[model samples]
Target: MMQEWRRRRQAKRVKPGDGSPLPRFRWWQLLSRSLFTLELVGPDGRPSSYAVDVRQAGDKDDGEVRARLYVDGALRMVSRVPARFPVPGGEIEVVVGGFGMKRCHLVAADGSERQLVPHPRSAEGRRARFDRDHPVASRGVGALSLLAVLVGLCLALPALAETISEIPPVAQAVGTFKSPLNLPGWLLVTVGVAAVVGSIERALRLRSSWIDDLAS
Candidate 1:
């Protein structure tokens, strides 16, 4: 019984078309808000024709779709459809079967077909290469973020402590020195200068590092 079922399924899978097959290409999806063409290649190892189907997801319109066949990047024959079709960008997908010679071409409404070419050296590939080459900056940013989290935890540690008994003497002394705005002017000025100088130094160091990086 199982053999009979398997034989029946295999028999049903046969297509009754001509045995001579053309190269097949189909639009699997359209994700970006961009228009594309669907080109079909003939059996003779060249781009033969294109369907004038606009690949908008939910557009409503009708027009003729035409594209010229090309050989060695030269125009050969023009094929046309009778009705105008609106392809909605971002929501619709147009499917074309059998598009493979050297490339696939999608015919636009303006009677022009755009060929799809494969690029091995794409932007994503370049980005991966860059990450592989100069990983220090990325790693440094991650390390700095982790260090910031650690510093935040260290600052919070005193708050988490059970009692003032565990607090440091310097913190206790600063708390006890209650002043009615009686802090020394010279001491305040000195502290302010130190803060400014420290901040400027850090900024200058970072700027120098960035400039050196760019120059490298």
Candidate 2:
């Protein structure tokens, strides 16, 4: 007798799914922290109509619940539903309960009704994933690097220009010291070549150090 009574009680609370009288569900406090998402769709199944995300909001097991709804890129509404209740179902028109309910509906060619529940993560998650996969916004860093290179070249141009015009004093002395045998020019040329080679070696070491900085 007790088993039969319990069965009857259970049957009273859940939807029959056969087009019988639908049961009215009492709002149960949902554990907001539980991560459950719902998706609602239109008649063609290609368009999204609504979404519900469940998450914990506070110290109690029943945390505050918030949902974000969008139509195109614009936000349509933000609302809260009682935890533990299956979010309402129906086409856009049937489900939208006035100002508070985010509604979705579908009418078949035969005039039958198709109900859809919104997926909470569809549009929201897609936007986040797209941002992660595409790094176009980070191109600003590359642009700044190019600008820095240009500025450094500008500052260095003056030194390069000066080097082109001014002959080394040592070179002038060697010109004066040249003999009919040209021995002075030969010795000065050998010394100048050695000096240039040394300067090149020092420059290579400095370039290696600068490369190390870039790596770090």
Candidate 3:
């Protein structure tokens, strides 16, 4: 019921596109842009093409991220993140995180959903190809990223608790708490960067958890 309400709200945010030609994905924008495509059969037994394009650089500069939906190489609609664009059979849903895309899938009327295929030149596409071509190496990298995020989460807990315990009322109840792993600033920065990269790697695979969603 709650999910339905959110979907309805997101669907309402969709706005008609200006029918501009779908822009080509460039090599230089590999890191900051993402594109995913989908094809569905219409009621008349005809096939239609759809694409979702995200410009993360603009999103980072401002707080709002916009997704463009293209049909048959022409712009059809656009919306901010958590968008739901009505398509032929179902809805194209898009959600994004700070580092990259978190969810972009076709949600059917019966509740089944399937991810959109990333464009050949997009970062997500490259990552998917890597996984297909090098399964063992891909799993190893994924495990490392998971470990990095886990370690970062462990380090953060005590610091967060210490912060919470420092509040006047809380401190009176539990006493002042101090974080145990008080390393140098530089090492902390390194861990922070690792955590961010780990999160981005996870985002590329469309794998997300509560922590990444909140942090990003």
Top model number, lDDT: 3
Instruction: List candidate 1 segments past 4 Å from native.
Output: 1-133, 162-216
* Candidate 2 per-residue C-alpha lDDT over 90-110 given as tens digits, one digit per residue, 9 for 90 to 100: 212222111122223333445
Q: What's model 2's TM-score?
A: 0.19
In the predicted model 3, the residue pairs found to clash are none
Report how far off residue 56 is in candidate 3 (Å).
0.9
Q: Give the lowest summed-lDDT range of ten residues in model 3.
A: 207-216
lDDT tens readout by residue for model 1, 108-139: 44656444332114222232344467788645
* Ranking of models by TM-score: 3, 2, 1
Report residue 158 deviation for candidate 1 (angstroms). 1.0
Query: TM per model?
Result: 0.17, 0.19, 0.91
Q: What is the lDDT, from 0 to 100, of the residue 125 in candidate 1?
A: 26
Candidate 2 residue 40 C-alpha distance from true site, Å? 7.1
Q: In model 3, which runs have C-alpha deviations exceeding 4 angstroms?
A: 59-63, 172-175, 213-216
Model 2: CA > 4 A from native: 1-49, 58-63, 83-216
- Give per-residue lDDT, candidate 2, residue 80: 45
> All models: lDDT?
0.32, 0.33, 0.87
Clashes within 3 Å, all models in order: 15, 18, 0
